[model samples]
Target: MAYIFLDESGHLYTQIIGEILEMYTPTTDLDFRVFCDQRHLKGITRAQFKEMLRTRLLPLLPKGAILQIEMIDSTTNANIQIADWITGALAKYLEKQKWGEEYYSILKNNIIGEGKELFKDYWVEAKTNKKLESK
Candidate 1:
């Protein structure tokens, strides 16, 4: 049997099932928008969130487990804070896997940049094709 943990926000959660470690910001919570609106006001920054995740997930995670982190899709949630948290989590996971700091930094930047570029391209294409109604 695998272990799973969830935070109060419900958006942030982690699970270790079999050989895979999964972390994600789930999109199904009805109160997620309200939760996001109150994010930093509660003094819970991305750093703190990352630490909380590590504290809960690390002990349960076995060595050589594959980490699968679900980053916020720009099309659905454009919150930069969530993106930052995902990047930080990725760095920690990569380090734990002994992938080296240099590789972590490179992957982090690519993650951040790739999403933005994809959103921009999608937006331009939609506009050009008149798929999105313009005001």
Candidate 2:
């Protein structure tokens, strides 16, 4: 069993990445590349992020599947920039904005996976526990 310590984003990010990557598991010989937007990360160094991902990912990837992680600057990458726009549009759509609704309607059918809130109560429980500890 591997142990990984996560702070804030690492916890949720790990679960999300784990859920998505499980679909593309490669054997020990092939490399599976995961690209993440480094700008969105808070309170964690890139090294910590990599370690957090490795611990969770290594177990799932076996045989030919080598995990290759690239923490990229969203500003410089066109793909990442487009992704940021899509995310913004999705958020706006959720907020019931007209512009967002237009973009979202075009992309809605092409979206993949269930966007269920994983570990939804985790932050609430964590905050409550911290308050108890402080008192």
Candidate 3:
């Protein structure tokens, strides 16, 4: 009787864990772009952009230690106004696209297991290009 009880409990635990693992697979990659004039590229620096991400965005991760953000590509111009605009636009896009809510769900679910670090390593490698308008 004792052995049967232990076996059943263990099986139940294993099944629960399996169900959880199955629910939160790696999220799909997201990509979008916004176009602005040369005047918009005045004040944003790469360092400041990264810092903004770390402070404004990184906290959304469920487990900071396990989940990390790796930016593969980000292009910024020297204009502060442009930087601000870009930041605001990004915030708007994320909100419009339901990223904030999805991120919250990820946190609440406590998804990702042993391979979380691997997922983090490849999370957001963006590619960007800049074009100059000819008058």
Which one wins on lDDT? 2
- The model with the greater TM-score, 1 or 2, is 2
Number of the predicted model whose TM-score against the real structure is largest: 2
Local distance difference test, per candidate? 0.42, 0.74, 0.37
The lDDT ranking, best first, is 2, 1, 3
- lDDT score of residue 29 within candidate 3: 23
Candidate 1, 1-135: lDDT as tens digits: 533334433223322211222222322332211112123313345555444555544455555443332334344665856655566666576447555565566666665322212133765686677854663
Q: In model 1, which residue pairs have backbone atoms overlapping below 3 Å?
A: none
Better of 2 and 3 by TM-score: 2
Q: Per-residue alpha-carbon lDDT of model 2 for 33-52, expressed as tens digits?
A: 88877755555677767787
Model 3 bad stretches (over 4 Å): 1-41, 65-135
Residue pairs with colliding backbones in model 3 are: 41-79, 42-78, 42-79, 42-80, 43-78, 43-79, 43-80
Against the true structure, candidate 3 has what lDDT?
0.37
**Ranking of predictions according to TM-score:** 2, 1, 3
TM-score of each: 0.24, 0.66, 0.21
lDDT against true structure, model 2: 0.74
lDDT of 3 at 80: 43
- Stretch of 10 with least lDDT, candidate 1: 29-38
